[model samples]
Target: MWQPFEYAPKNKIIFGKNSLARLGEITEQFTVKRVAIVTDQGIIDTGHVEKAAYYLTQKNITTYTFSDFAQNPTTENVTAGVDFAKEHQIELIIGLGGGSSMDCAKGVNFLLTNGGEMQDYWGYGKAKQKMLPMIGIPTTTGTGSEAQSYALISDSKTHRKMACGDPKASFRVAILDPSLTVTQPTSVMKATGIDAISHAIESAVTKRRNALSASFSLYAWKLLNANFESMLFSPENEEANMGMQMGACYSGMAIENSMLGATHACANPLTKNYGITHGHAIALMLPHVIRYNADHAQDIYEDLCRISGIVIASCAGKALARRIEKIVAATELPTTLSAYGITADAINNLAVEANEEWTAQFNPRIVKYNDFVSLYNKAL
Candidate 1:
């Protein structure tokens, strides 16, 4: 029997090679005068923010810049953005960067509208007031934050990243311009590209997955899994970059409909403890998680192997895991916990946190603290 499911979509997406050119026109759709451009210094330094600002400026729109957020946006970051928005009396916002910039934009929306802090809206559907209409302009092919409603803001004291979300907080429009991603550094491409792949694989077998979410996941898998090798070497290829952007965004849609699983559950603990990048953390543990979830999700794994043309090395799950491990290696990222300098003694502590993560509950195979402990050991 099929489980009953519901899908809710809020954002209107505009995707193409030069979608950023329509920024000014998109802003005109909403009745707003002052607009806040929420981004990070890295994006500003790249001149992408200025390029986006030009479009709005041409339409005689006043724009205020707020670029104080970190790569992993924190409560403090969102708070500062709220202050900026309040001071500027921003009637709208434009998120023009990668996941960090877009996530901060959603975070800013949470507090600016609801009269509370980021931590207050930590769960889901917590907003009460209508948020400022905003446009998302993603400059990378990772995280797919543009396609989702949740803002992953880190707690100031505990450092636990909160998935703060509300339908109102979702971007009114997402403009995916592949040309913007061409400027991304090779390291950024690897981290974000792998993150998309993780989303593709994890969403397919998650307990909350439905037909809609599975289709998005498989489509994402097909786009990204097939191009990993070529994209790594030909990062500047226009077609490959376009496919990766769509792949990441499609996986984000899957996450929007369903949710992630143990790889995310394990990765969060690694990020909090080791200060490792989120993509690197997940890439290290995802292969191990595939093996962990394999017995229960064999059909799902086999489906990915078939659709993505992954060669099976005797076992559906193990083969998929091995294939992914090789792909991660192509990025030259650290794939083992030991390589990251994490000690054997820390597995218990890490497992405790991993087990407590909300995503852990959705793992197709029930995840216990011991399972996490063992998985971390294998990654080591």
Candidate 2:
């Protein structure tokens, strides 16, 4: 018999080539007037923030720009953003970049209303009160922060990344425009696309995986697998761009319901320590993690193999590992930690940290500290 589950907080999804043009209409739905546009310096450099601010200005909405967020948003950055929001009496937030901006927006909302540090809401459903309305506009195809209720925030002191979530932190609307993604460089596309693929694969094999989540993951995996290579090899193809955007969004939706597994658990520390992109870290660790999870989640791995069209018939765990290596090769992503300057000692420390990560609890395999150590050693 199948177990029961509840869906995530509902969201309004606006998707298309130029869906960002509807931002004003969507923000008005929540009766927002003064808005805080949370983003990063890179986004401002790309002029995406200016474009979003223009849209709000055209609608007669006052816009406040908060583009000081870091690549991995820290508590201090979030606190500063919250102070800015409060100073302007901002009624709405528009997250106008990748995961960092959206996460900073969520952190600002949490600190603004909840009256505490970002660490105060590190776990699940910690916020007891409501938050301001947020609209997320993703400029990249990865991270899927626009669709989820959680934010990945880092501790200022320890540099440990925390996953903060509350039902109220869920976005009121997500504007997915492939045109916005067109400005992303080849490196951004490669990293973020791999991150989306990891989300699908991890969600499908997680302990929380259910029928509803599996359906989303299957379709997301199919779309990502079908279009990732095309997008990488043929950057000018409109169809490939659309598929990547849609697939990334679907993977985000899947993670909203089922969460992620060992790959994310391991990747977080790599980002925190080495300053690697989240997707790049995941890609470096994913194939090895997939091999590890397959030992315990054989049936689910086989299902994913069939869905990804990686294997024609039943295959052993090694085959899945090899397929992931092939995918990594096609993307030209690093398959080993050594290529990224991650040494054995760092790997050991990262293993300790990864073992402590919240996502480790959802891994299909019972991940002990030694298991993390082994995986890190193997990845290196």
Candidate 3:
């Protein structure tokens, strides 16, 4: 009784403990000469960017660093990065931090070849030309931007995050070295790990979910649910770190085909106006959104609860809410907006913005403006 569904395009994934050391080999394989390393100042301060730059330098690939990107990348940042790359004649781009750096790199590629502002490509599949060669290296366990074809770029004028999609913006290769994530702050690790869990949970129950996407989501949920606690308890454990990285990557792949739902849609406004980290904002709102969606997608929610090993009397909406509450408690994430200094009145504007987010349309339950308001109020 299943219908045909389009499959997402595949890309190369290089994952391991020392996979970062292969950057030189990858650059040589792609015949890239001048490369731009896109990252933020915090990554540079961590010395990981220097390590990556050294690898490229040893292979005779001239590396230019772009550390001017903001925490939440804006269209202005993308334009500046594009200008730097063009002026330096860079042929390849390496995104070497979390989602912001990777997103900025994708934005840079989109503007470099398409010759338009980020606003022009706000919707899906807008790029007309091939993008420059790009590689993504994730230093965190969230967002999964390294494995996605879409980049979330903020508009400088309105400060709203635009979800821009193009096959050309996909990375040629993603190098996931879990070792790099060990240095993340404890709060960041916990928040991003919760974000990865949200991806798995959301993808499993999204309206677009199919057999293949379900397969990835189920395994991703298992991996994340099992290892997230281990990573929190033993942050430096290589095996646990690898599990988190692999789970996050799989969730990213699932999202590529199925997209995210109400949680992400609601979370975006918090990041835009409240100055919250993307992962933290998403984590804070996810449990309530999951409960909301469970009312409409009970069968899928029960399936996810079973896969995540949450014992319940039945596969009901309340059972899903209890299970999500347990996960949120385990992560030490804030479960309410008030805990994050957001007021109940803020829900009105956030609801207005969430209703306009591109991902809201894909939720299993139709997310109307009133629904967003309710969800925001519930979170508060």
Candidate 4:
């Protein structure tokens, strides 16, 4: 039986090498005046901010820069950004880095235009006012925030990640320039690449998965699996870089159509409790979650394994789990929670937090706190 679904595609994506050239024209289409570019200090240090600013300068567009958000942005960060944008009377926004920068831009947009606390808009489509138009240029291939309507912000008070979303929050345009990603250091590359791969894998069997969304995840899997190694081992491989970016973007699209699963559900508690980088936390937990889901979701996993041209070792679900662990290890990222010094005592608390995360509800299989506890122990 076919499941009912809804699809509303909102993003206009411009992809290629040096696609950043179109920023001025895109902003002109929106009649942008003064603009704010939201990103991190790393991007400015790497000269991407200057490069983007130069393009705006060519068209006589004035700009403000905000790089004040954390890796997992906080409500305070968005509040500060909204104040900055308001003080400057910025007319348009550009997010010019990884997920953090893009998400921060969306966070700012919510409070700047809508005039409310971040908590007021914690779920989907809560904004009742017009949103300032924004463009997202991903300097790294992770997070896929550019392609989705949700902003993952952390509550400064609770330290819990919040999924604040609205149609208005989705980027007006997403610029995927492969050249921009090639300059990232190996650590950034590995971490973000794993995140993209996880999106491709996890979104495939979520309860919300539909045929259209599944197509995106499956193709994303093929691209990421095929290109990930080349992008890592062969520095500046333009073709490989393009594949990874496209894969990540498609995976983002899948996330928009469906949602993530228990891997993310299990991953979040690690980040919340241990201050682990989101990517590494996800990498540590995903293999175990994959194995856990496979008891019911094996066909989906095997299909992806086959489509990605990976050998399903002995035609068993456990092989797929081991393969995921191998990929994480090959990236040289930690594959165990213990690597980060998280002790057994942490599992009980982490599982409780995981149980509360909304993404766990979307897992293809039913997940409970006990299931999270088991998954965390296996990850350890």
How many clashes in each structure?
Answer: 0, 0, 0, 0
**Residue 323 miss distance in model 2 (angstroms):** 2.7
Clashing pairs in 2: none
Clashes counted in candidate 4 amount to: 0
Q: Give me the runs in candidate 4 sitting further than 4 Å from their true place.
A: 313-316
Which candidate gets the maximum lDDT versus the true structure? 1
Model 3 residue pairs with clashes: none
The lDDT, on a scale of 0 to 1, for candidate 4 is 0.89
* Model 4 alpha-carbon miss at residue 180, Å: 0.4
Across residues 157-225, which tens digit of lDDT does each residue of candidate 1 receive? 899989988889889899999998888889999999999999999999999999999999999999998
Name the weakest run of 10 consecutive residues (lDDT summed) in model 2.
311-320
Residue-level lDDT of model 3, residues 182-284, one tens digit each, is 9887887887888898899888888888888888898888888888888888999888899999999999999998898988999888988988877778877
Q: After superposition, how far is residue 123 of candidate 4 from its true place, in Å?
A: 1.4
Off by over 4 Å in 3: none
Whole-model Cα lDDT per candidate?
0.90, 0.86, 0.87, 0.89
Residue 137 in candidate 2, Cα distance off native in Å: 0.9
Give the worst 10-residue stretch by lDDT in candidate 1: 226-235
**lDDT at residue 16 of model 2 (Cα atoms):** 88
Show model 2 residue runs off by greater than 4 Å. 312-317
Model 3: how far residue 7 lies from native, Å: 1.9
The better candidate by lDDT, 2 or 3, is 3
TM-score of each: 0.98, 0.96, 0.96, 0.98
User: Candidate order by lDDT, highest to lowest?
Assistant: 1, 4, 3, 2
